[model samples]
Target chain A: MNFSSPLTPTPVAIVVGASSGIGEAVARKLAHEGYAVALVARRADRLRALCAELNARPGAAHAVAYPHDVTHFDEIPALFQTILRDLGRLNVMVYASGIMLPSGFSEYNFGKDRATLEVNVLGAMAWLGQAATYFEQAGEGHLVGISSVAGDRGRVSNPAYHTSKAALSTYLESLRNRLTRKGVHVLTVKPGYVDTDLLKAVARPFWVVSPEQAAADIWRAMRRGKQQIYTLSRWGLVMWVVRHMPSFIFRRLRF
Target chain B: MASFPSADRLALLTNFGHSIGSVAYVYRPTHAEQIAELYRSAAGTGFTVGMRGAGRSYGDASLNGGHVALDLQRMNRILDWNPGTGVIRVEPGVTIGQLWAYTLEDGWWPPVVPGTMFPTLGGCLAMNIHGKNNYVAGPIGEHVAQFTALLPTGEEVACSPTQNADLFHSLIGGLGVLGVFTSITLQLKHIYSGNLKGYAWASPNLRQMMDEMESLKADSDYLVGWVDGTWGGSGLGRGQVHRAHYFAPGEDPSPAQSLRVEAQVLPDTFFGLVPKSILWQFMRFFMNTPGAWLTNTAKYVHARTLDHRHHFLQSLVAFNFLLDYVPNWEKSYGRGGLIQYQSFIPRAAAAEAFADLLKLTQRRGLPTYLGVLKRHRPDKFLLSHAVDGFSLAMDFKVTGGNRPALQRLTDDMSRIVLDAGGRFYFAKDSTLTREVVAESLGPDTLARFCAMKARCDPQSLLQTELYRRVFGSI
Candidate 1:
């Protein structure tokens, strides 16, 4: 349907790394809210499956799967442009994807740390870089990056993972500050433990939340145009204590 | 090798029941040329190919066991739209839900749609789906102005009512046995607004339910019902009769009428889908037959009080697709998934046919998981399911230890339906045999369809597992 009579164009949103996990849920939720979604992910089958499920719902809008790997930083622009061309408009860009590997300083693996930074920091920056420019030019849009609660405080156990998220968090904040005056809202979504296959190993999870719940919280925050969100609400308090704890005491803590 | 992309080579498909199938390959083709190439290659390799759209057919209709399956879901695109003419052209992968989403804003909607909106337009055409108002609107094929199909021989054939009429009719209900539908031009139904004024008439017996349905058929713009199939004795088939029509612009809706907003299109109204968490999937484990029976009974009782006219004004979404109120609602059926069996019986034998169908399940203590009844009338499509009668659809939970019994139950019910001058819808049917299919369709219609199939797909490259399972006699 043409949005000619309406002041705004058709609402479009792009979810990078939507093949599975939280990114898939966010894409589905947004499509349910009448936003035409462009699902970007490396696995074409998963993306296509998710897109098909979204479009098949009784009250759904269009969802097209754009097979892509955000790690391929150079191609992010082409991906966004294709979304604009195929979906007709752009209103939201959610970089809700990253890579994490568990390792202590003693057993630190070279490749894991390299990939962690490449995806969590450099890859996110590359994708958000394109989103920030496009939204600023459009004069209205929402840019979101799913950072982690781990970013609030550095941990000795996984320095690279923590630092990569911290960098993503800082980058998102910088983008928010710069884009705020341009009417483009940038949101940093930080979640604690989410039940996702992305984890390298499973543990008895604490405050374990599902991706759909995380997506819903993020969706609510984005709708309210909130600058940052700590999913599950309780995670906000948990992160607050982690952020406010004395440095010496925190250094000695094994948490 | 044409460089088929696959991090995991086998693209497996699972249904609502969580039943999984691993195929030789899965390809998401962007164009018909890709399908032609695939068919050409399959011919060379002697690998039977099947076309899949959405893969929501509840069974293996879209699955190709030990063969190559083409995933066409990614080909969805609304190619063209003419608001005034209500004629829209879309790729075969375009879904019925998507068709309504695009056209509803322009006050146009597809004339025929199944209960759930998950099935793709191509899938619906392949099944020739009928809706609540089938008695008046006919099957989806009637609303299709034309369609293009990529035959197994690599021929792209365009067919419509006046052009390639034989292929047009056969393809409507040909399953994937004809070929892959490439692009479709559909004629949509026009509506004044998204609002529907409706009411539910409560019935206490099968006789009264069918009687009320017969009387209401001529008056209602749209009609469907929910049957309490597990209710035994004289109260068998007791349920509610749903009737509705699009409210004319500026028409005054009664205060008693509940307002429903077309989901995703309009803002939330008094009637809207409640939010659910990810936990809902795991929580649906309580969806057993007994659990379903309790819910169904409660729903039926609640519906009984709203007899006569509530004068409710509902959004098209709330009326036609009330099933979507609970997101991923089918998951409630739990790990086994929901198996839907819908039977269409000529009005002359509906009373006896539906009674026997329900009684068989009731005797076995299998709750009809979900029972929906809709009035139907015939269309000219060669393999059409509607037959100037009433069609009743019921779901059976395919949980552990129930598959064997369910199979037997389906066999007994199929025999009863066939004997009572009733036909089965291939889309919802998973167990109909080749002999039953020939008997149900009659000799002439079956023979003609086979001849057409031979003419178009002589090598049977387009034939799927479901086609062979249902019509192997051909």
Candidate 2:
């Protein structure tokens, strides 16, 4: 979580969905790592506050505040243009903005599910596409998409959120393919249960990772040029067991 | 308009693995059926498919331009891990980093990992990546119990030393020519902590250093030496030799116990990667008289004198994990990038040929920042790069204007290697000619590789740009 204290000469980072949860933590970590971060979120006030706090730090005067909803695809272009105008070139872009709706399979809410899909899938595509455009032009950049271990396999409990993340994961994979030749690295950051606001409304486990630790893992994955990394990497083994559960025994078990 | 998906970028490197290209497509096939479907679709079409694991390769070996680079990153599912047997089966995309991350926390460690811990199991098997402990553990192919390879003929065949032995041997170091490796089973090592009882020694000259390395090979579990590449004459090869041995079980384990350690702090960061201009300027200075030799000797003496405490040092995985800090540090060399020249010379001829190689480095005026010398055990795999010899791996930061000179140096070094029956590691190759590859690896070995390719991928569907380099288009 305190990954940035020892390093200097921060790179320029663009964090989409920096209002809360993993996005906020990523923005903070990137800034701490000496990156001149551009905070992009829906709420202008929240971003401004984060930027102010970053600037207040010993060596974070370069942190910039840019509030914009990632779902607003039409506004993404201007956002990048502004970023380039203010900061020159972007080296890292993290898409941590997402939403989750808790509901059983039988009693699904279309409205809630659609909203989750919008923020998690469509929003990711729009922002990622924008990032890809810049990376292709610059011929080098890193695109990190915050995903979840749940995306590994669709769970019956949260089908909508699972499907959206799974799709986003695939899209990032495709984007990585196109961008790799251009020297652009695409990373899919998949975390397990985390102590974040998004999971607050749902039932959670006691062993969930803290926001800082999750951010650290994401940062480490990007540094390693890992295309798709399981945060805490151990979670990959846990999810492996969860994913390979036989349906007969799996359906009988309760979460 | 053609939509180049990310998964399809691997094919671009099928024609010339070293050529400049961008990743345009990537595919992740979680299931075997998906991989088979991809293979079938690309069978007749001219589209190339290159398998991509962790992008740890220093050269263009893993890159494929204008084709789908099938990224198996998501395929990293551990199918089975038997602690009692030390056999772990996983998808081809699982990397050594993941292996260590998952297993080391549980008191298990991978026996071998190259300088970098980012390559996938498939990439390791394909490139036959070796490590510092190669003298003890051998190349990655030796640890691999078996693998399921996807041939261009769209067949899923499980190969092993005892089963489909030829395919298994050819596929391991075949550089992905045999087919797409979907899964691999390997033998894992047991470990107590991330600490090592290690020591470093300073050698004065090349002959003395070579003799010291040979003596250490008799007893050391892990051995690697840092050589002064810029220095020539009888005093050349002098630097530091590091020898590490794992404490016996239930013996002297570090008191400090932690499953996960914090990230190792780096001298730089992503935002402040060393500027290309600065590196070029430094290279110019380092290439001048008394620059590299003096600096390297100083570093060697200083490093050799470090106090060894509990050595609560990072695990082999973390110790080698530099990229985890400066994410884009490689780009510090800029667009033209740099090249790594790693060659293996028979231990008998190492003293002479390595001396010649060092002389060439001085003659060509190549600024080699790092010179790594390792003692390797003879390998059993057909296309494996490790030989019963001394291997030297060095990084040359190429200035675009001086590329031709670097190539000339490489060509001369390759000739010395060919004459000495030494082989060049294809994984780090960017300038090795087809003839050098054939001469060094042996014509029969190359013929066997060609025969296997003809048998499985008659139309040359099982291909890589690396294959096209030494063997031409099938």
Candidate 3:
């Protein structure tokens, strides 16, 4: 039993897109681990409800709700400073704010693709860019961006979503390369099909994992200082096979 | 990543005057060992710790902003008390209110107290606070017999006037930059009764007021003047003076009852009618310039016509802790808060310097609402703000529109004060610049103080916003 003294400071973590899914589960896990968690998402009601629930647990660290839309790129800098001021300091930041829209195989709406790219790729850059600057100056911090295994290859199912994930993964990798020498860790999380709202459109998704399981995997990888990870571990083998396949043969595959 | 597993929650802390504020990681350590542990943890980390006691300063003296605030309020304990010899040893967190409440029944009182009794003894020593009797007894540091402290380097040492004399004098006024005070031993004043003979009189102007205070210093134990900052021209610096004297050995007929602890507790109501807690709400209506002028005029008129040359007996608490009479009275200044600008000018230059300052305020249409006048004699502390002169403290209400103007005004006032060979008090400052502090303390004294800081805290881990603002990485 490790009882904390009254003078002990609980580490602070900020979880974007914490209104639901992987971000929400990660917030809960961090709170349970005695980390003061800041929940940021577009859904104010969901964030408040989650905050209340997390705060109601006895001996849990404090949780605060910050209602924000990640697409509001200009607001991220000020909000980031406000969070640092309110939470005292920042030790970790998780960029899980993303969006995946359903579309027919024959349909190609630029509006849907634009929204998906805005939330998944641009939003992550805007939010994580702040963490990068701060962590670089402070010489110590953790940055996690939740990409996806779908980024391994462009499938016939969704082109924009795959492109966004690929851009996110490449961005995270570049950040990891640049920040490694500065003592800052950047983790690129490529989670397989997780049972979240984003996965509701899929019918009989194979190897589907729960949001809690994915969150546990991300936390473990982050603690172990892994630069990249595949949720459930088995997806590593599957992605490897997919990446090695020739484009001429991959074109014949259907969802 | 480097981690602080023992850090406490984040807090937004403000000064007692509600003037300046900041956010920091606040920690409350119960024992000296915990403070040592904190020092060890923060050794290589980029976090600086500022010591806070009761948070009674009027400015940023206790604020760390973006760092750690080591609040010693929870370390309060009366380690030992010798009522027979009027000596007591206590943890740094013991408040003046607690000390008085515990020893009043034994016919003992703190030798040097501020205008309020809520400040901790540690904070009082840190600022070297003075009282109405400062001219006679000097600041609180003069009454400290000895103290033990833990330096940021994890060195525990004892200091007194004879042992580590330089460290003793510097730490008392170091503004909590060198070390953390663990136990403080002080010599208390022995009294025959809790009641003091009081006398009240009004000075027609600033010159007469200074003369009266100078003449009354020998006969009075405590003398304080309340200046009407709203007055101008012929009536400039006009105010009321209240002098108190302790009772002789056999002066009081009921010394036993008068010395009881219950007799020293301030009443919770105004004349047993209105609850003092709610008076601030009513006072908010008079917080504006016109309202303050009207109120000051009325108070002066009442004092001159009815209470002039009044002689009476008053309790020690009533005479000393007037700032605590109305709880949260600062709230009346509104959310913009208020700041106090106090300057200690040598007697030769006080009358002229104070007159210039008062006239400048009126000319700028920014007169202070309340003004306090006190006589002080020089002390041996390294950072001493006292002189063989008079100190005038003025309170100004802050507003968004007047913030820049207030800063400019303080800058101009600093020039007039510095020209007159005056000093600045850290406890009541918010707008002083590094240049002003450098000129006030001189280079040699500043170098000596910084050398001591480097020796005691080699890593420069103990710091506050005031230190940064005034010293700027010295």
Candidate 2 docks at the CAPRI level of incorrect
Two-chain DockQ for model 1: 0.01
lDDT of 1 at B134: 90
Clashing pairs in 3: A7-B6, A8-B6, A8-B7, A8-B8, A9-B6, A9-B7, A9-B8
Q: Which DockQ-derived CAPRI band holds candidate 3?
A: incorrect
Give the residue spans of candidate 1 off by over 4 A.
A1-255, B1-8, B19-24, B249-274, B277-286
Mind giving the per-residue lDDT tens digits that candidate 1 earns over B1-474?
443222133444555444423333567889888788777676744456777888877666786644567888888999999999999999988987888888776768788877777778888889887878898888889988999988877778999999999899999888878877888999988776667778887888777888888998888889888898778788898888889986665563431232212443433322345335343575475577667777778878888776656667677776776665555667777656667888989998998889998999988878796788888888898888888888889988777567667777887898999888889887776666777888899999988988988888888777566776666625
Model 1 DockQ class: incorrect
Error of 3 at B92 (Å): 0.6
lDDT of 2: 0.73
Q: Give the lowest summed-lDDT range of ten residues in model 2 chain A.
A: A1-10
Scored by DockQ, the top model is: 3
- What local distance difference test score does each model get? 0.77, 0.73, 0.88
> What stretches of model 2 exceed 4 Å from their correct place?
A1-255, B1-24, B253-295, B304-314, B318-329
Better of 2 and 3 by DockQ: 3
* Local accuracy of candidate 2 as per-residue lDDT tens digits, B1-474: 233232222222211112233433457778777877777776656556666677666665665433456777888888888867678999888887778766665666788887666678888888888888888888888888898887878778999889998888888887886788878999887765565556676777777777888887878778888887766566687777777776566653442354344322233422577643345444445443366667786787686576342233444544455335434445545445567788888888988888888778877777576688888988888887888888988777666476667777787888888888888887888777677777887778878777888887887755444555567776
